[model samples]
Target: MRRLRQLAERTPAGRERYVDLLRALAIVMVVLGHWGITVIGYDRAGRPTGHSALGDLPWAWPLTWVAQVMPVFFLVGGYANAASLTARRSRGGDATGWLIDRSARLVRPTTALLVVLVVGAAVAHLRGADPTEIRTVVWFATIPLWFLVAYLVVVPLTPPMYALHRRFGLVVPLVLVGLVALGDLGRILGPAGLATGNYLFGWLAVHQLGFAWYDARSPTNPPRRRLPTSRRTGAVLLAVGLVVLVLLTVVGPYPVAMLNVPGARLDNAAPPSLALLAVATAQLGLILLLQAPARRWLRRSGPWQAVIAVNSVVLTVFLWHLTAAVLLIGLLDALGVLPTPRVGSAAWWAWRVPWLLALAVVLAALVAVFGPIEARTRRHGDTTARGRRRTALAVAGYAGVVAGLLLNSLTRKAAPEPLGLPTPALLAYLAGAGVLRLLRSGWGSRG
Candidate 1:
């Protein structure tokens, strides 16, 4: 028992490597998952005609295991939120302002992107493009934005929901798991059932897991504290999580989609599923087990520091990734450079990989364009020059987004269509970038 306690309470070396590695790893999963859907065309489709051999290969679901790293994102988010709230309270900062700033950090960038997309689609229609085609293009271009809406819904609720964490401890996640099962069962049996409501409770449950991890509060259970030993608890968590995952996959209606396919009946990802909860548990255990090794690795790796440096702009990367793909595709098609989005054959997959790589490069370049705006707003600390400079840049970037949105609207003057990559999108990019920058600077400064 004493040995078990030591293992459980033993602190991983270095500062927050598990969290950072998890975040980076989660983001990588997200990118790869997206790459599969858009570039790889992998996964089973509802219809036989929808199958793509190259994309939906035998290894797809296993790949989804890596791709569904979203649960970890929420876990990290919970940890960060708890840390942020604690830090802010310590400094006597207004809770309202802290939340407002956080909300703005998400909203500002997100709004800009939406405005651009909505406006750009409208313009493409005005230019005499087919309405369905325009809509299809825009929809594909901005699919990942759904996370923004979901995150926002959960972020505001964190203050209150976190209380449940204090009371329930790790049991909160189990309760959430129960809720998902209930929700799924209801949807399966009832007439008016859809899993939409599950989105609120189910995903929030995942997010709350992070809060528990955060609020566990002690670095290591004190040697004198009579809590269950770390080794025993970890082993228990690992065993149970593995068992649950196997059981759920075998018996559950869940489809193991870490990424959305064009036509899926029940998206395990759209609202998430109990399967995801199990995956998260297994992942959390792994993270805990390897904390020491991850820390040592991060310390030794310089490139990792670069990744950490850039993670502040995670939303930026996530939001614009689709646009980058669309832009590359649009340009290639225009120049007779790239083929249409047809899924089949190794040849198609091979060609698409380079295009996806090019898409990533373009996204990086595009993100760089907004780097200045992102930098200004995300600055921390009290300084007149920094504040003034950030405020000015923020305002200008916001204005650019607005201007772009307005221009996109006007560009659609004669005929109406949804906005596309027209002027509105450009404005949205600037606006979103500027707003996130401001918040990053403001929030970071306070910390």
Candidate 2:
């Protein structure tokens, strides 16, 4: 607490603390929302079995309007990336080296988590636990990796994406939206898997909104230019978003749920749709309207310190929270203390109280254990430009890391009876981590 206060006090006066606040808030919501909707019970074999409540209960769909908060994260991502890239360029670093630096921060901590999970998988298999069941839990445990994969995809594009943002302004996102709609149409009418392109388009559009916020908060942007987050604009966004959201989900084909519900025909999030973008607009509006007050509140020492503390290891908390929850669930199930109530019943809702509490306790412990790994990864300066051979290694390193993360993000339906990542993908990820570590070192760069 004392260290956090000192760190908070030392913050640059010009820093946009609210963006940090929004990021911390988004992670909290994602964790809690996942905990609440998780439907769980011990099977007849006394093994744990569960899935998203959105699968078992339709009424829970409306809660997604509040629970789905990734848009805010991406928006904040855009703003932060814009700031970071600006700072990097100001320091004379190229995008590739800067990207390598960025990738290491995320990838290093991720490597720790994957190592633990892989070990756990092997242990379970050795203990005669069903490989299929072990893989099921592993898949759930690694769900957060998909977002990491998606974020990694965009992080490298930040330089170019910010370029487009600076040159074209709002038109960039408008065009991206057109692409998102096209992707959605392809999903419906074209060949299978074509619409997956929106995974990048839809999120990139939201990230672009952050670029707008970066400019929105900048004093250098001309005052004569229309402010992106003005109250009037927020109102318009909120109104249009609500109307379009209703039209798409109610009158149009998209499902009401914002997140992917298992067994659903279409997921607004998996391959984001027009509906998800509408949600982003409304979310962005509320973010705009709330921006000032949020900044004001965050200015206080106590609040700013808290946000700082969370942001310091937010990735660790995110990476390990589900694993912690699943572990606790298993423990409680083995102890015969875990409850199994009817889905959507009053008791089930009440059960979330203890469930969340237990998960929190476990998650806090796990964070304490794993967060230092992330802290050690906190980088300040960007990597200097390296030669051609180094660039090739960096490219291969990044490709392998993202590819491995994506491979592990598969569902049972996608890779039937999957029992952990394929050996080659795991090897790629491990080899990639080794290569990246070498690139980070001056000694390795010389050769």
Candidate 3:
């Protein structure tokens, strides 16, 4: 703790401390929201089943607009990526190098989770666990990887998108918003396939705004710069987004919830409707408005240190949070202490505080065991033939991880099979991690 405080005290003078704070806060909110809404119960056969509390309480949909922090996550990702790309380029680094380095950070920590799940699932299956129960458990654990898959795609595209931002500025996000609207319309009037494009376009648009935010404060581009950090700009964004969101829900085909409801005919989030984009706009606006104050508050040593500690383990917390919830709930159930309150009932609401606390304890333990993997950094091998080959191998490894997660998201099934996990995704991820490890060990020796 003392070391962390000293580290915070040594933070670079001009760093955007607020970006880290926002990212950490977004992760916390996402974890809490997931823990709160996930209602686990037992079937007549005494197997665990889970559903979201929001499905039962439509009135709570409005709350999700605030709780859905994914926009902020991407926005911060854009800001950080722009800064990273700029720094790397100034040092004569190429996009491939930057992509490999950035992707390694995500892929490494993810490999830890995947290994545990794969081995644990195999053991459970061998022990004669119900296949349906195993499937449910594995599916719940891997569901959060969707964000990782999407963000992985967005990260590699940052180089090109940053270039586009440099050329067209705000027009990029505007066009993306237009595309989101078109996708929503296509979903309404045509096949739902058109809306799938928005899954990328919508997030890319939000990410583009991050580039805009970075450009607004660019040290190089003075004449073209526009300060989105200004309060008035934020007010305009908030007002416009809120109005559009209300109209989308009231008059358009979009649902009010920023998340998917189990049986909803139209989900704002599944394909990410313009309504969700509006919510993101409002969130970005609110975050920008709070940026100045947040920066000021973060100037203090204590708060900044907390943010630093959290950011250091952010990925660990995110990847293990759901697993923690599952394990904690399962333990409590086995001990006959877990409550099976009706979803959205008063008793369920009362249970949320304790449930979150217990989940946090479990997550903290998971982090203690696995957090070092996230913090470990290895020196790059020499860039000769051996080095280049290893780098390529590392990149392939990261790609496999992304592909596996994407497949899992699309299939929505990550169960344990007798020989392996349900989908080929886990195999891809494992293969990728293995190649990277082999390169790390053998690349320098070959040189």
**Best-performing candidate as measured by TM-score:** 2
The candidate with the higher lDDT, 1 or 2, is 2
Q: Candidate 1 vs candidate 3: which has greater TM-score? A: 3
Cα lDDT over the full model 1: 0.60
Q: For each candidate, give its TM-score against the true structure.
A: 0.74, 0.94, 0.93
Candidate 1, position 75, lDDT = 80
lDDT of 2 by residue, 1-447 (tens): 889989998999989898899999999999998888888876687677877888888887877877899988999999899888888788887666776677767887899898898888788777887777777788888889888888888887888898888878878889999999988888778864768889999999999888888887677875432246788888888888989999999899889999989888898998778999999998887877887788889889998999999998899888998999879888887778878888888999889898899899999999898898887775546544457776778778888888887766654522433345566668878988788877777424543
> Which structure is stronger by TM-score: 2 or 3?
2
Ranking by TM-score: 2, 3, 1
Candidates 2 and 3: which is better by lDDT? 2
Q: Write candidate 1's Cα lDDT for 65-133 as tens digits.
A: 556777788888888787677676676654444554564556555665666767776677678877645
Tell me the lDDT of candidate 3. Answer: 0.81
User: lDDT for each of the candidates?
Assistant: 0.60, 0.82, 0.81
User: Model 3 — TM-score against the truth?
Assistant: 0.93
The digit string of per-residue lDDT tens for model 3 on 285-341 reads: 788788888999999998999999999889999999999988987898888887989
